[model samples]
Target: MPIEQGSSGNNNVGIGNSNPNAMLTVGGGAPLFLNQGASSTTPFLAVLNSAYPTDARYGWAFYDNSTNGNLDIFRRNGTSQGIQFMSFNRNTGDVAIGESSPLFLNHGSSNSTPFLAVLNSVNPTDAKYGWAFYDNSTNGNLDIFRRNGTSQGIKLMSFNRNTGDVAIGESTPLYLNHGASNSTPFLAVLNSVNPTDAKYGWAFYDNPINGNLDIFRRNGTSQGIQLMSFDRNSGDVSIGTSNSNGNKLAVRGTIGCEEIVVKSASTWNWPDYVFSKDYKLKSLQEVKEYVEENHHLPEIPSAQEIEKKGFMLAEMNMNLLKKIEELTLYMIDQEKKTEQLKSIILKQNEIILNQSKRLEKLENKL
Candidate 1:
């Protein structure tokens, strides 16, 4: 190959070309290459070997992509192969590690030819920092971790791109807001299969029209079924339904519980106060009149009110107790009246007996 030097004073070199604009130019449909011999432990194009002795030990080396089609970026460790910082498959344009094809290629689960990894066979246990994405060949799961001056790498999340499922590790997502700024704040995740698949997935989003946060499950491309809803206006929550109209919590179906405690009972005035000395007891006639007029007990909520506003658990319990205590008082008063009537009847019977005895003595005298 005849080499020609540039006419300019810069002394630019050109191969197979008359003119050269750069330091060196090679033309004539040929490639510039370094044939460092087969299995040679040497740097083909070394740069400042004495200055960067450590980096130069396993750096600036290239291989012909013929045998396994792996082009390793670095050659580290005392071994000739060295730790592969990154490797690329020239034919498929896929990234891999350990000079081997990714396990996902044979498993046929991941996205098409999506493989990017970092592997160190020598120090396999040592964690790599600064944006190291690893895909476990054995587990067949992709993991992302971050090590910011910490002893252990925090596995941020694991994701299966094909399934579009992401599992969070120890770290959790947080929202920070101190004052009312009228900022519409929310977090949502959506996952779905291909459009043709009948079995669908789930989604969480805000319903602007209804003022609710909705979590729904989709099935067979139909309108999603709401699994849970949180009312933004009233702070009410509903399960198996969209709107919790009146109550703080509403369930479309029955709720089964082993034990239920009315935790807010302290806010209610218990009905034991009905027995206080200052309390006035209504007569039975007055109660009868009130019942006839209102068709419900006094101090008790009507059916309409309960239907619209929803009954308070603690307050209703206390009201029922008050009615029970009132009934007890009525019973006690009736028992006293019956006792007086019985005494009067007994006295009358004794007087009649004395009168009969006196009449008998008078007849004997006659």
Candidate 2:
């Protein structure tokens, strides 16, 4: 016969270890209430390797819904739990499984993929940095999760952990190359799907030719302009070098203004014509008729005739040598027939004057 200890130290109720603390608190004649360790001397159980049991041993004394075992993941020494909850062994830290333990996994409880899994097979140190990956799924891609160093959560792309650089989109997208310097300005490539060819993308250089950040677009050809800088603030521009004093200077084709205003001929002369109400122009047909009626040219000597006069003037003692020489070159360029016509008019005028004089003399004789 197995003799068991009972409560009520008087009258030899025969409870073993009559010390009040040693007699485990029994509810309904069973030891299952905040008293798993009441029979033992230890106060709390130890956890090893972040797991309850070191090895795969599992066991349970007893548990009921009314008990506090389901309250928290871990509890203090004096907390209430009617059952001897499973724990790691004091030596190897493996779990101790009772013979009649239930099948925990097949208990119809929800147990699927875990919410977080960190495998640092390469590095064995602690996860000293913040969260490296959140919501990392099983898609077989290299992924990272990011967080603010402080309380605030992640602001931008969260899961990019390439050092000395930052990347976005499916393994790589926008790459900011500050690998040269962690603190200073950096270079970047945008919309880059492939780093080898860098197709359909642009490159950027911070603190460019004359200390200006330059943005360059690439297509079949490449074109670039200075965007901004610590020294100069210009958009779509190219900056020149500084003088000995180290001041910013504008290069050629870098205008000061954002846009240039071009004016048409009519609008440019608006001040002169501002008061006019309307402008008028006759049609092409009217213009043709007017020109036909009024246009006529008087008969003139050829330029050759005028040049001959220059030669004759020298012979007749009328022209100086300098004048004749000047006229010769002028005649070559000017119209010659017009000059000949003028000479003919002068001769006719002299003949008319002589004839008039003869008529007057005849009248007086009569």
Cα lDDT of model 1 by residue, 1-366, tens digit: 878777886575666656643345455333222333322233332221122212334333444435565554554454454554454556655554443322112222132112332333212223433333556564555765554333236655665545544544433322111221212223322232222223345545567778787766656444356788889888899999987877688898889999998665456677788789898999999999999999899989898998897677777888889999999988988999999999999999999999999999999999
Report the C-alpha lDDT of model 2 over 1-366, residue by residue, as the tens digit. 222354455222112223223223222222222333322322223221211221222222232213322211222223332234333323332232221221111111111211222222111112322333333244222334332333222323323234435445433356555542212224445444333243445556565455556554544233333333334453334443222133343343346788665445442322223123462333445546765764521112235655674233223322244334434544543557677888999999999999999999999999
Highest TM-score against the true fold, candidate: 1
C-alpha-based local distance difference test score of model 2 = 0.35
Model 2 stretches astray by more than 4 angstroms: 1-163, 180-197, 207-209, 218-236, 239-366
Candidate 1 ranges with C-alpha deviation above 4 Å: 1-96, 100-112, 115-201, 219-221, 245-247, 263-268, 304-310, 355-366
TM per model? 0.52, 0.28
Q: What RMSD does model 1 have?
A: 12.8
Residue 273 local lDDT, model 2: 30
lDDT of 2 at 290: 61
